[model samples]
Target: MSIKKLLFMVVAFTLASAAAQAAPLRVGVEGAYPPFSWKEPDGTLKGFDIDVAYEVCKRLQRECVLVEQEWDGMIPALLSRKFDTIIASMSITEERKKKIDFTEKYYDTPPGIVAKKNAGFSQSNMAGKRLGVQRATTHQCTAEKMFPGAELVLYASQEEVFQDLASGRLDAQISDSLQASEGFLKQDMGKGFAFLGDMISDPGCQGVGAGFAVRKKDTLLRDAMSAIIKGMRDDGTYKILNDKYFEIDVYGK
Candidate 1:
């Protein structure tokens, strides 16, 4: 009836509408591996994983909050409720399934090893060489298992592993093949480095590749995310994001 009353009602309605549309969700991503997941200097998390998490939230019509977390403790953090879900490129392993559930893999890629182009590192004579690997990764387990006799050097992040390799502190490094190629080997710091051999695809050791790890109790959310991932793939959103960071289909079989 009154102008003042109408204004108050409009403001209240606007606030309610905004609140209804903004159901916040916190997502954890490993902010180290570039082209996949990494944190900017200003502490913003960005990359394929972040984009996918945001896209999932968009599909769910919710507000997604990105949380930058170190890779090793991402599962523990998830169990502790540090975030609602993990979009880090964590593998969908049975070992992990015991602790957390995962949607079907969002993408599948093999691991690769890198060394100085002239290093002549090979699977045969790697017996005593120092190898760098990120801690708590399938790469660490697979490298240790497959390349026995080489001394394993573990780091918290792939960035650190590459740093050690570039500085000659490590004879070689192993990580996600795409990350090894683009995140390090193709960069200036990786100028002298090159992949040692074929991409390693030990499904048992590497799990079934990368997927979203969710709390075991969150079945509804997990199903929602799985459907979203498939929708993104079928609708070409996955291709657009994949091509933005990689030349190949990271979602491929």
Candidate 2:
């Protein structure tokens, strides 16, 4: 080929690749919950949920972009096409299913309660204590339903709930066990806190673990994401990522 022709072909291929990369699919994340999704000191989002979403995109042969959205508004944003999907450790529940479809669950964790260590309260003593949980989350629903008379204080994010609990504004807090273990119980701020043994058992409150949320009409996107999750499960990549952050195999034996 002539030098001029070869140069032109190279330029054309470069432009095509740039366009493809620019057309990445945007995925929403809360960017405030550690061990699941959180923003680093440098303002970049990083966590298990973010990693899992990237892996799924890799399998689908699509470029992935992370969009930070408030946890409370994630669903509404997705429905409005603010993003193509949500991988913010959102639990797949029937209520959510009514508004949006989900890929197969990618992770599962139980619910647990955190209370002041010397508050003289155990799992059995949670009758009237004020409990804090993130608004619109399964944890909040579980706390309200399972502990009917207990006071429930809803916050906008897990960090806010924990902050209140740490400041003694809340008697206790309920959240995902993995997050409790890794992000709270294992942290410096958790030194004086303890996890009560009681577990919230409502599948609806706990949901069917966590999954990717896509608009109900996006069957192509949903199926493609589901296939990626299933393949990861079969090949052990999913478990590896889970264990890296959770220190436990969340996928079960």
Candidate 3:
């Protein structure tokens, strides 16, 4: 081969290698939140949040590297630089904003109560019943305030909350309304379960809505992601994923 040709090939290969070296966007996710994020029996993650993350990465022209983190440790991991961002359906509460920044809300939904159809718990009163909720979630905060009299049964994961509820160990549970409906109520184990009363909306604990969370210093990345999220909503990409997981529009008014 000619020396000139060899030099040209070397430069092309170097450029290609550099392009390949572009860092992938490391996204934190919780594999236990169903309909939004969950692990299948085969250990593959698939859910609305998962889809949205992949879509956002595609628009950003970067490869996506999903890092599974427990729900309770999500924000701490992000702060510790374990991941660049969290796309795990985390709510954008003022309390959290004190610790990190959030992109514009991607979706909004209210929490709901789930109980056996025969259970007679009032919306305004549940003096001594056991109420299950995942630890460190808006649902926990909301339940504590809304049903101050009820005993809060804290669990590590929403799946565990559902399990206890299904076994009659819990009188009720408070969780994302859509998640309860799709993840538990619609399933076989939840055959006799139904949502009680109206959906609960507490701006204080539940926040305005769910959004992508990033380090406070990553304003540029947050803004870029916010724009991409807006684009997805305007271009119907958000609706496509929303419809895939929920029967109704979860992006609240």
Candidate 4:
């Protein structure tokens, strides 16, 4: 072989070896969004997002590690390279797309309002209520726009909002329908709370649905994840996870 070609081959081999030794894909999740990703009492993390991410990594032939992060800082952490990807039930919105890339949507649920059963409020009655939502979430933005007169209380997490709602600090709370249905409705703490019909609109906030997030420059990783997510949807693993958490199919045909 020519000397130039031999040198090229040696450099290529070294690069390939370095790539092979790259660390496992580290996925960041809030680890507090029940039915999506959350920590168990035993310290292990599990849920829909956890299951879906595991499937995606398996399809990509890559090991997966889950990193617990607060909801407010999840995106910034992703940009700072604290994790390789985010699977924290993040929605694909134009606002977010400007900062980071997203895989195709894997699950979806409309935004809904949860209020005390005796509150006697509907979508139209939201004018004076104190609505609680997680800070830096689409729900918070939607509540602000949809109910201009309502007091929007931004909490750090869904758990915090729910806690305040149960303790009578909040008149109502807005969140994804599936999350309200599973995490709140099914729990004892949500005994007297009810969804005031579906307040679906604003595809950017309540309609489009959820997907994983990655840095815009990680095109290879994003493409691989998108393909894996598509396969999971087609092969029914996605449905199984949905069924485990929700009574109805949130990801429709």
Candidate 5:
């Protein structure tokens, strides 16, 4: 047999072997956040972030497995290898970068406050009114640092923060503006509450925006997802997703 033909066969075999060995990536998402990710009543996970994850895996020629993780536990789970990456709407903050690596901002949105229409809450004169935010989140950190005088309450989930806001246990709730808008203010339970104050931006706390979180050593997967995100944004898939889940560009200007 010719040496050229033998070399061709060897190359094809090696390529096939590598393809066969590549494992599906297990992606973690906080299932409680809507528009980004959530479990359907039927228990299947679906949302903008999930869609993005599946497409990214498709582009990389790998299967994507979705794992539901509590918002606060996502980083720990990733470090423990509970999942390969976190595609939840986790913002890319400086503080988080110390522990895990992140893809470029997949999406960015401002933070805001919510309160009963008649309730008076502001950065100024917030001494007596209480505020609530989801624990272990940028919102919690921002509220703590920004509202030094207000009594800040932290909840395990954004839903709980909204619950307390509705029940009057909290005079106000702080969260991602999009979540406060579409997730609560537009819903039945948000009947009397309205968005308060301007959209908040503090790079120290909020950073640029949300990104796919990966273990620090997993540069290959991180780079692949980042390329896919840039491709989607250039193409129109990202905008299509933004339109589907939200009325505004969550990716920010």
Candidate 6:
């Protein structure tokens, strides 16, 4: 009956109402992209993208729902509404822009090549050699255009590409530099292999690094998440996540 008690009850009710109305943000992730996202032996998803997704949803005050999707199907699954947004490390390429909108870049590592130590491969001398790349990715585009002399082999996942490279089925492989270092090169199977040459420079195909993809009409969601990404960088939250997965800042200059 007191005014103080009435005001406290009103605020509590409002808070509870807002909590009840908060919808879950479904995030699409490739559970096979190492360091970015991958599955554990028990099938639990963990990686940089997984961590970022949870953090973004936490800041947005929404329940986080992760949708596991294959790399090749990421955009199609997004367009079909299988998930509300893609937290997958998908590049912001011009070709993909036609199908979906992207948040501002979350990270901008360059693509690089992995080849056996002492291999006499060069950017212009890979004729008849098999080069592996993830299908439908910026790496594939760069390899196709830049290394026309090499035979391009496509795989559904980067893991497979690394496997073929390790087994000598592939002469070399192209992928995000950080992922190649952390996911493959540092492992035992990657022994005697080293990153060859400079990072692949193809701005037209790689676009402006990686971003969250949402349905083309979901500009509001895109902007909201983009703002959260910037806040994380400003507050050092992004660095914590970046350091957990990489030795250097993958967000680029």
lDDT by candidate, in order shown = 0.88, 0.85, 0.92, 0.84, 0.86, 0.92
Best by lDDT: 6
Candidate 5, 74-115: lDDT as tens digits: 889999999999988888998999999999998888899888
* TM-score of every candidate: 0.90, 0.88, 0.91, 0.90, 0.90, 0.91
Question: 172-239 in candidate 2: lDDT tens per residue?
Answer: 89998878878887998888888777666788667788889999988988998888888898898987
Mark the regions of model 4 whose C-alpha exceeds 4 Å error after superposition.
1-18
TM-score of decoy 3: 0.91
User: What lDDT tens digits, residue by residue, belong to model 3 across residues 1-253?
Assistant: 9999999999999898656736689999999988899999998899999999999999988899999999899999999999999999899999899999999999998899999996876777788999999999988889888899999999999999999999989999999998899899999989999988888879999998999999999998899999999899899998999888888888888
What is the alpha-carbon lDDT for the whole of candidate 6?
0.92
Q: Which digits, one per residue and each the tens of the lDDT, describe model 1 over residues 1-253? A: 9999999999999898756757578898888889788878998888999889889989988989888788888989999999989998898887889999998889988898898887876866789999999999988889878988999999999899999899989998889988888899889999978888778777777898788989999998899899999999899999999988988889867
Worst 10 residues of 1 by lDDT: 17-26
Candidate 4 weakest lDDT stretch, 10 residues: 198-207
Question: Mind giving the per-residue lDDT tens digits that candidate 4 earns over 160-248?
Answer: 99899999999999998788778888899999889877656787555368888999999988998888878877788877877886677
Of models 2 and 6, which has the larger lDDT? 6
Q: Quote the positional error of residue 50 for candidate 1 in Å.
A: 1.0
Q: Which stretches of candidate 3 lie over 4 Å from their true place?
A: 1-21
| Model 3, residue pairs in steric clash | none
- Model 6: per-residue Cα lDDT over 164-214, one tens digit each: 999999999999999999999999989999988888889988999999999
Q: How far is candidate 2 from the true structure (C-alpha RMSD, Å)?
A: 6.4
- Clashes (backbone N, CA, C under 3 Å), per candidate, total 0, 0, 0, 0, 0, 0
Clashing pairs in 5: none
